[model samples]
Target chain A: MRPILLSGHTRALTQVKYSKDGDIIFSVSKDQIICAWYAANGERLGTYHGHQGALWTVDVDPTTTLLASGAADNTIRLWDVKTGKLLKTWDFGTAIKRVEFSPDGTQLLGVTERRQGHLSTIVVYDIVLDVEAEQADEHSLRIVCEDSKATVAGFSYGSKYIISGHEDGSVTQWDAKTGELLDSAQIQEDDMQITDLQWSSDRTYFITASKDKTAKLVAANDLRVLKTYVADTPLNSAAITPVKDYVILGGGQAAMDVTTTSARQGKFEARFYHKIFEEEIGRVRGHFGPLNYVAVDPQGKSYASGGEDGYVRLHHFDRGYFDFLYEVEREAEQANL
Target chain B: MSKVAGRTDWAEEEDEDSLALPPPQITKNKDGTETIVSYRIDENGKKVKTTRRIRKTVMKQVVNPRVAERKHWSKFGEEKGKPVGPQSDTTSIAENIVFRPSSNWKTNQSEEKNPIDKQKATLKDAKIKCRICSGEHWTSKCPFKDTMAPEGENAGAGAGTGAEEESAAPGLGPSNSSYVPPHLRGKSGVTGERMGGGKFGQERDDLATLRVTNVSEFAEEQDLRDMFTRFGHVTRVFLAKDRETGRAKGFAFVSYADRTDAARACEKMDGYGFHHLILRVEFAKKPTT
Candidate 1:
């Protein structure tokens, strides 16, 4: 699969997401601009421009109506996707690292770092009922680990559990409604930070990409490691196709500083692997810098990735990809014979 | 025959009368013997008489000595130590004059002035300097080579000087300076090591538009939309038609609301059979204008 490149941002990109309906693409960058593009042609539809600092992450609801963006300005702002208007904002009193909506679109999850204590907390607010709900401290379920900071989080496919990944290589599963910690596991060694987490379409398994140069796919119920995708460089983000048994991992040689491109290593491309065999299938090359995020569209036909180079790329699987899988299988069978 | 001879005699007499010379006369004798006499002026202006003889004896001798001389020479020329014995071919003469004397000359010549030595001498005279360290050596052999290594190797050194140089140089100053050492500090603005990716992503946008051809001539916009909506949301459909006739032009454009849908529709509906016509679908190129 060859990727289509989208260019607009001038600074490193932090997050890129496709709307649930797959009609719009939302990307946030360190340049402090949130751009919404038409998913079909990559035409700039509108820009959401209210953030005072660099935006860190963005997530779209299942209906593709509301877009939630978190920024270093210590606030999470929700915008209307169609009208490009700011709908609501929550002051978290700290820098927000990531913000995402529940699969049901009823709650919004934001991971923020307290400036004074240097502690990270996962705050889930009920968005469906109360617009001016008492601050997240009162109405939301706040989950904070004592020492480890949360890096990434996502809701389960059924909205029954919320999985939060920590900087200390630990992953914890919490009950969505009761805010109870159901299970936790150390999925990575060496205290490597988890960069991103992605759930498989069926919710049977989820993969966590870490700074340890590996991405591990684990069974959701027991959190047992299924397969490990290793790379020479740290993997920052990974995504699984909604229907197909394929996973795409994105990273590059680590950047020494956030601003300069002089100290980066490795090529910036999305590496694809067979979900079952864990064998590398193909790679899609783009992005001039390390990739930070990759999100597959809901239909499983295409995926989008953003990187430190500030460009977002959309890749579509061609008919030949399916045929290539069969050809690989035949080659494997011939080897067996 | 007598008349012809009389005519010849008259013509000869006429010529002799004009030149003041003698004319020939033929007379028949009683025994059937004929005698002819003619007179002409000689170089000393004397008249000479000529008589024709009926019977004469002729004798001729031819002498040629070249063949015999060749035989004599061939029989004696093979003697040893003689100049004519086994003459040297042209190649032997040329080899004696040119190659034989010089065969060992190269060995006696100066070995230090060979082609490679001359080339080295010219290079030494030119005094080439290294681009990196500006020394009298190649850049590859520059002493500061370790400083130009990748950032990971020099990370400790870079971190030490990073703070002091951070404010002085903007952009990639600290990062670039850390990799480049003091001896190689003349040229500035050295970007960094080149990262790898497909070069096509430099400026060209990914394939978002698909130009679909081979559409059924009878296919309408709604039919196209109905067939393609299964892949993704249909945004617009443009079917080519004759300007005046208002008839289908055998092709159409079906754009999707999402690029993934357009790609999916192109994959599935291309070569799709519709109303006995196989449809061809592909990404459309951007309009050049």
Candidate 2:
């Protein structure tokens, strides 16, 4: 497979996302610039440049009209994806760590960093979902994490529940409308923080990547861990593929200790694991530094990865990726036929 | 250096200016390729003519209407007012990687000697261009080696066995490591033997081996080993064969554990008749510079 390298970021990339149609890729970096690219050819669509501090997270709405990003500047900002205009900006007391839009694109959520006497919280706002409309200033619901800070949060299917992965290695399910905690499941060891949480195509189940060097798949409604994928290094991001029963994970040695270890020893690669078997299938190695995030296309034809080395690699899968099958999987297909 | 197309020496400046130049032209060939001929005057006031053949084909694909419209969206923010298409400063294609995920991908990476075999396969298909038409190749393969004087400074470079004396000349001593045309490296065949073929004594085996020629095409390594083992201990027997057909190419090499045994076999096999032809046997000579 030939990879297309996107080289617009001057600093390490923090996250990348594909549009609902899987055509455009939006990436944010610590360099304070957000870039949009055509996923098929690596062509730069445009750049969004208003954040004053390093960007921590970015998310595109399901309609592909509005883009949301959280930054260390103590605010979450929304931008018009087509014209690159800043539509709305929500101020917070603490820097926002992660931002995501609900499945129906009617609500947006932002996770705040815990610092300076402020307990971390997840806040939700009613989105107007139009480029020309005015967004409300007040948050519709705010869930305070009184025990341990939440690092990553997202909405469940039909907006029935809100699932958040926390700094204390627990996944918590909360009532989306009332902001009440329903259930909690400890997903990782040693109080390691969850770095990323991404939803599957249906949003009923999700994958969480943690600093404990493992990624886990959990049911959203009950907060029950289903499958666990153990990797060699601390994982920064995890993504579930749509059409294929596979998951892609990205991570390596932390950026601070990267100078002490070589790339080979750093384990700077995206590991692919079988969703049911929980066995590693293969790894794609390219980044000289740690891989920060990986996002699979909605159509499951390709994937994109952002790295600490300031590059986004877009890889289109070859025929072999779709052809590989385990003995049992092949027999199952034959039985179906 | 001497390969520059328009570098005329200062002494030939008058003669170069006395010639008239022709206009550039482009012609379309019947095979759907275009032939472009262009001329330009260089900094040295000499003219150069260049020829290029190029083929162009257009591909079409049906895409989603929204994606098709988004491709024409105007550049904004930092890319404001920039022209269409991917700017060179940002996007690029990286090297191709062979990614075939099998059930045993994790175990398959451990025992790979396949890359070296792939390189050897590529070497077999490498084109041999002549450099008198190409000196990057062997002089014997160049049709113009005996007829043409090499271009520019290399004109005085010898064309035959005199390549040895030319390489040892005093002028080339300092920058000899830079590049030397292949024809100037002599026909000693030393450079060719530097790589492998090590199963038999590519290194020191020549000290106790014999080269047998005029052997029948039907000759096998076992037959040669049987014939030569009568003298003493035969270490190895190698019969050069055609790759497609398993027949020998009329030659073989027999190695002995002792040099005296090799000498006795060479004497007995020299005038021996085998399969309607007399054999010529001699001590295998080692390559030397």
Candidate 3:
């Protein structure tokens, strides 16, 4: 179990996506560069320079060979994993806030950053199936409302629906096929922004992390409110286990002394995986910075995370305590992704 | 002696002079109390200012240790079922799994915790390198090469091996200096080194077509009609199924009955959105049967 150290891009890596087969990991940073690495060894593969601005999100098709990326540059670009070639670029005239590939790997979903007086909207597109074709008005679906601002954080089940976590702290479920509004609700009034969204393995429920330092579960079928788990610290990222029984949350202690606190040097007083039953399962408490992201593997056995302190740490539960495996300093700039 | 009345006048002048004298000084004593210290503001007139200092004692707040005791999931099983105890040394197994989306969590029973017993934690730590000769792995293809170099060797195995040697030493020195094959390396152990491969050792060819199923027998026709009309205007959908099973092949031979429809649908709906599903719309195969 040797942890591989990746050190090249110079800054924190904000976004990372695993290939369909989980063989490759693609990551991007605030440094405005994209890197592909062999998942197992953390070996640097190649870097793609497409977005002039920092990349916010990157998603690999769950079943296909296409890779979609959304960035601060206000354009979404399709890339071929084999050749690292850019296929097509679509301009939404606004910065892309989130990018995701549907469950079956057929469509690409992108959300826009906030605009003045107008709500954010999500764009759905059908990527040209043939690798050699070129046309802009191909298969496409666009869903936007005048007063609604939505950031589609992640997808659920087979991509039949999406849980859009808005900057306003609202979570809306949309029927992906019909572009109809399924159900919408807010955890609190413009107080908690859903930083991370994940679906249960069975597609039965989805969980969200709010700025209010709590993770709530939502029933997907009827959009019913489920249990809400509060963290001791402010929340930055959250993930649900593939088995659907647990969740992993990452963040740091809320600043107790606001006036004397340093924004850039926050500490992660606690990071842990909690059982959905409101039970604390395992925790890591040594990080002297805020946690940026937490990711569970496909099998739900072990999880990995990255923090503002430039460390990618792996944690595993031994009998009843979490044992730290390795912590690697990812020398890339990770900001919003 | 005769000027007794003049003496009274002189006495009045002396009283006015005494009014201009300074006040006395105040200071603290060794017993934590205050005292007056005498000082002079000028050589002739006695004037003073106090440098008195005061001290106050404060009591520290204390919390009941029992009330502060609370337990957490990360430290739950390791410590007693209280919050403010010594943090436990162990954690539940559910702590490490990656997260996914769920739909059944409304019920309190939806989430469960797996209890960790006396099982020893099997920490995963592996060097990403060759199993045979030690070398840097980013450029190696020899399945089994050493990650760390042995004493006295350059740790570099230069190119190419015979078929016999390659077969015998399935896990030998690294090969291929130019490209890194994506398919390799075992993740933590649940999935074998090739858990993602076909059930058997056979590799599926890149051009192999998938069989689609589940839609009505005319699913082929309906999809073709619906797509051509919406994709930008004309054509067809060919539903491909298995020959003997009569099941949808999980894929359809979609054709734009019109070439332009085919071209446009290819452009617009190639990756069309569906409920819980995203479809990869492509050109259908011609009916040869």
Candidate 4:
């Protein structure tokens, strides 16, 4: 599927995600605004504008009722999606880098760069209380890995484990309930920072994008490197389609202060790679700046991407794309016969 | 005993001597002894000290007076045709002051001396005289001729044939010349080619419009207008929608009140990656009809 333009942000976009049903898109930007739009149409449904600083990350729960956002203001705020009302706020005591909801929506996972240390701490809060409860730290667990700052983190499927991507190019797995370090392995060479980590729908493998100019699909059980997708630029974010064997990568030139002649040649578009052969299938070019995040929707019908240009684009896959895939598969089957 | 007494007398006389005295005298005695006497005044200038000495010894000169002579050399025969000395091979001052020719000049000179040089020289010397104007230069460079003429007897043909010949050779017509007046040129009819016939196509002189592409299929006319109106007073927005599906076809044409506003909008919105698409914005071409 090809991408379409949907511009509105006045500053750089930090993250974009789709609601549980894939009918709504949520995007946050450095302009201190969180906006919601209808996935089928480019209509601005509502904007949540209470943050005092630029938002760094955002995520939506499975029920699509609560939205969690982390910001550079050293706070994580929960909002009621339908009403655009701030439900709760927690002073994380550091600039939060990433936030995610546990699969069951019973817990919230947040990674914050430590205020006085070079490391980041992943905190899982027991958020099962009703909307009125104020004490969120009663049953929270803080897991800190020494000598490395976590760049991105996510909960494994069914909340069985928590995996955090670190600036030291390592991916560490932790026991979610006990806050114990289960296993850790270097996912990228040369100490390249891990920019993002996303799990496949089946949870058997998770994909990581790094500054080392490669994205790897790693087996979750043993942390073994399964497949690597190489590119010419540092990948800031990556996503795997839920049903198809496709991986989408987004990145551009390292620095933005390049000459206008060189800046125009930046690979700021989202590139699609075949998950099996690692061949680049297609590219969607629209952003004149670096792409910061790419998120495929729950059903894989559409995907949302945000970039340094302060734009959030929602691309929908056409029916012809799936038909083309089926034709290729059939031709391969015939050739084998 | 008398001689000793005489010497003592002389010593006593020398102590009372004055500064005024003759040159010193030396005498050779029979016993081969030489005696000399000299006088000098004291520091007070009132008394003179006389010094006298006698010894039995032969006189000797401190400096020798003999001259040494060189020995004669044997006669030898001379050899012929030998260089008198090493002759200088240094470059002259004039040659050193002159700058060396560049490599390009040397190459050109070498190339000119090849076998083709004779033919090239002959061709350059062969000049053409124009038949129409009887000028010494070629007909093409002749300014007196009203129309360009063909070579030699071909010019003898009437004006119609001459015109055909001129037309066959492109860019030789008077109409192509910048000096030719627009009204006097052949085929002077206005084809509206200059106004609208370039690569970007004809542009409307009044209404400034922009062709916007890569629009979201879900975008509405109002959304595009709202987005573009920030640059200027947007006069109209036309989102092309599919007839059967009733969805946006992913393109639109936006018009502004002023051309400058349209240009500003294009600069700001072109290549704007929005909603998963990169937008393309440029000046819209006017319809042919």
Q: Number of the top candidate by DockQ? A: 2
Inter-residue clash pairs, candidate 2: B130-B133, B130-B134, B131-B134, B131-B135
Judged by lDDT relative to the true structure, which candidate is superior, 1 or 4?
A: 4
Worst 10 residues of 4 chain A by lDDT: A255-264
Specify the CAPRI tier of model 4. Answer: incorrect
Q: DockQ for all models, in order?
A: 0.00, 0.49, 0.00, 0.00
lDDT of 2 by residue, A123-235 (tens): 99999989999999999999999999999999999999999999999989999999999999888885998999999999999999999999999998888889999998999
Question: Going through the candidates in order, what is the number of backbone clashes in each?
Answer: 10, 4, 78, 11
Q: Assess candidate 3 and give its lDDT.
A: 0.54
State how far residue B195 of model 1 sits from its true place (Å). Answer: 53
10 residues in a row with least lDDT, candidate 4 chain B: B66-75
C-alpha local distance difference test of each model: 0.68, 0.84, 0.54, 0.71
Off by over 4 Å in 3: A1-5, A128-139, A253-270, A285-288, A314-337, B1-289
Better of 3 and 4 by lDDT: 4
What tens digits encode model 4's per-residue C-alpha lDDT throughout B203-288? 22212678899999988888888899999876557676765588898988876656677779999999988677899998785433
iRMS of candidate 2, one decimal?
1.1
Q: Put the candidates in TM-score order, highest first.
A: 2, 4, 1, 3
* Alpha-carbon runs more than 4 Å astray in model 2: B1-58, B109-289
Order of the predicted models by lDDT, top scorer first: 2, 4, 1, 3
